[model samples]
Target: MLSIYIHIPFCVRKCLYCDFLSFPASERDKEIYAAALLKEIETEAFRYEERLVDTVFLGGGTPSILQTAHIEKIMDTLKNCYRFSSKPEITIEVNPCTVDKEKLSRYKAAGINRLSIGAQSVQDSELRALGRIHNAADFFAAFHMAREAGFDNINVDLMSALPGQTAERYLETLLKVTGLKPEHISAYSLIIEEGTPFFDMYGEKEGENGVERGLPSEEEERRMYEETGKRLEEAGYCRYEISNYALKGRECRHNTTYWRRHDYAGFGLGASSMVENVRWKNTARMQTYLDAYGKGKIHGNVKEEIQRLGRAEQMEEFMFLGLRLTEGVSRAEFFEAFHEDMEKIYGPVLQQLLDNGLIDTGERVKLTSYGRDVSNYVMAQFLF
Candidate 1:
């Protein structure tokens, strides 16, 4: 089954710590961009006509900012262009400040069954530090509004290791979020990305402010991650991925397609697509995207980057991505895919890691607690 991703690259304002390809909204640009997105989808539909889409995810700068009619038009185009699975999982990412009861209801009517709200943190201070437009109350109101609008499958995004954030505060935020009982929780550690305001204001100006004004240290971040896993487990949420927790049967299908290396289609500015073992991305420039579409130049947006993966690269990706799961990569599946036993390929490394108490092997190869703590280092060992 295939998955579809639509990027909406407009937000009210950029977050201080965000380096995503997005811009502030403009009426003229929004109108042009939406039309271009529709055109891009139509142009690429023929390529995936034989495939069935199991998941449809509308992600963005802020998909919730679009008008209901615009969203509906996009959905209508998708329905006309592609065949969906009998029980497709459709999701849309929303910013709390951009949505209300009416918009949420319209989104549901447009065939979006899942909502992923960007509620980075529920603390006002943390929100301000991250340069978020909405406060904690706004997020709560949006969540309630989404529920009222008949959305049952909901995901909330949270962040740990924020500037000036303490472990106590992080735990408190986690407790408050779990109290809401969302179906999915995505907790990511803050990364001070280059080109972001936060990186310039704090990261680049190192030594200007005390440690309290910067991101949490590696040790503290690791503690927060381990504690999060423990807390979420206690709350009946399974760690399906390193940073993603879900109630049983609530794992995100679209994201799973990615980790599993399945084919998918992406439309809109800066959206990346993987089809027929070929991966490509659209231009990130909004004006360029609109101009090309207006000139009936749909193919102009696509940049063919990786045509296919070699055996070594594929194996490396398979192990790394699969290891992100708590259950880890299945030895049987690896052999089936590669026609070689994983143990045979990396026997010495596996034995060494096991001897070092970094990995466990049974039906599958998985990182132990220590390995999980230093997953990046462990993954690097498998790379060719």
Candidate 2:
């Protein structure tokens, strides 16, 4: 089986803290891009005809911003080109206020079974500070609209550790979301990426004056993170992955396929795909991609940064990615895939991690609570 990711890299407005590959586009530009995407999907379908596609994720710069007809056409084309499984989980990522009840109802008719709403923060002040186009009331409207439109499987995306955000305030946001009890919740801490506005205000160069500038202190940030896990768990949502929580049976299967190192294809600008140990990413340049499709060259000319993983690389990935799950990596499955005993290869490293109380080992190996707190350092240990 395989999963498919379709990227729609257009948004109404770029947020201040976002560094994703997204931008504002005109309606004409969107029409042109959608045509190119359809051509690419048809072109790439032949190679994966033998596999059954079980999940389709429409992600990126607010897919819900598009006209309902565009989304319906895209889904129709996918159903035509690929052989899907008996029950496919089709999801679309939406921003509040970008979609109305009518648009959401059309999406349901088009076979979209899941909705991921980008409700970063519920506080109006925080939403404005982050430069979000939607306010708190818009999020509530969107959620209720989705329910009225018949979407039961929904995921709400939340973020913590914002500038001027306190732990108590973070809990307030958490409790408000938990009250709704969406099937899934993804809570992430804000990271100051180099190219975003938040970086200029809070990056290390200005760290000496950070506290005066309203950025949360390290103690407050850590407390916020701890509180997120505690509050979400108390609400009966299980933390199946570091940043993702779900009320049983709602974990995102597409994302889990990525963590388990399964074969999946990505379509659209700057999307990445990995299959049978070979990986490639589509060109990020918009006009370059359009020109390729114009010239009837969607297959080869549009692909870039292709690499084939060697055995060592595969083993490294098996450990690094699989360990991210709360259940950890399976030893028997590791041996079955690599044809070697995992202990024979990384016994010393495992022993060190075990001794340091960073990981626990049983039939499967997984991070301890403290280990997950410092997951970056723990995951880095798997690199060769």
Candidate 3:
């Protein structure tokens, strides 16, 4: 089975902390992009026609920003072009301000089984700081509307360590979101990427005595991260992945495909694809992409940065990616895929990690809580 990701690069406005490939566009620009996206999907389907699609993730600059007809057309195109599994999981990323009950209801009709609402915080001040177009009240209304629109499996996206945010304030946001009992939650810490407004405000600034200004200190950020697992588990959610919590049987299947290194195809501007160990990304240049698809030349010039993974590189990916899960990598599966015993490849490294109490060894090797705190370091050890 294969998974598919479609990117929608339109938004009402850009958020200060965001560096994603998204921007506000006119209706005509959206219409043009949608047309090109449809053609690309149609052209690509010929290559993966035999593969059964199990999951479809519509990610974006707020996919909910699209008109209902546009979204319906896109879903229709996908349904007609691909052979889907018996019950496919289709998810769309939504901005609270962009969706209403009618829009959400149409989404359900379009076979979108899951909703991922981006509610970064439940504080109006934080929302304003992030330059989010919606307030806390708007998120509540959107959630209620989604539930009313018949979406049972939903995920709420939250962020901690925001500008002027404290652990107590983050905890309150968590409690408020959990009170609604969404099936899944994704909580991420803020990262100040270069070129983003946040990079200038927080990334470059140094507070008194070498402290960071306008954001939570590293100590408080650590507290927020640690408390996330504890509090979510207390609220009946399981931390299946490092940054994701979900109720039993409600984890995101689409994202799981990525962590498991399964084959997935991405469509639209700046989309990426991996199939049969070969990976490539679509051209990020919007005009270039549109022109290629518009002219019906879907092959060579559309793709850039293609690479086929060698055996060692594939093994490294399998190790590091799978380790992100709480259950970690399976020794048996690794041997099955690579035909090499896990212990034989890195027995010494494993021994050191075991001695340091960073990992638990057995049929399935998993990180200790301490190891997860330093996951980058632990994952780096697998690189050969």
Can you tell me which runs of candidate 1 are displaced by over 4 Å? 204-214, 217-219, 295-301
TM-score, cand. 3: 0.97
Tens-digit lDDT track of model 2 for 249-361: 99999899999999999999999999999999999999988987754565546889999999999989998898889989999999999899889888998999999999999
In candidate 2, stretches whose alpha carbon ends up further than 4 angstroms from where it belongs are 295-300
lDDT of 1 by residue, 1-384 (tens): 789999998899999888887779788778778888888889888878889989999998898788878899999999999999998999999999889899899888989999999998999999999999999999999999999999999999999888878888999999999999999999988877778888776664334442556667667777888789899999999988878999999999899888878888888888898776667887776667777786556654455354677788888888888888888899999999999999889899889989999899988999988888788988888988
TM-score winner among the candidates? 2
Q: Order the candidates by TM-score, highest first — what do you get?
A: 2, 3, 1
Stretches > 4 Å off in candidate 3 = 204-212, 295-300
User: Please, what are the lDDT tens digits per residue for candidate 3 over residues 1-384?
Assistant: 999999999899999989999999999888888888888898889889899999999999888888889989999999999999999999999999899899999999999999999999999999999999999999999999999999999999999988888999999999999999999999998877789887776664344321446688778889999999989999999999989999999999999998899999999999889998999998888999888876555553588899999999899899889989988999999999999999998798899999998899999989999999888999999999
Cα deviation in Å at residue 114, candidate 3?
0.3
Can you give the TM-score per candidate against the true fold? Answer: 0.95, 0.98, 0.97
Clashes of each: 0, 0, 0
Record all residue pairs in model 3 with backbone atoms less than 3 Å apart, i.e. clashing.
none
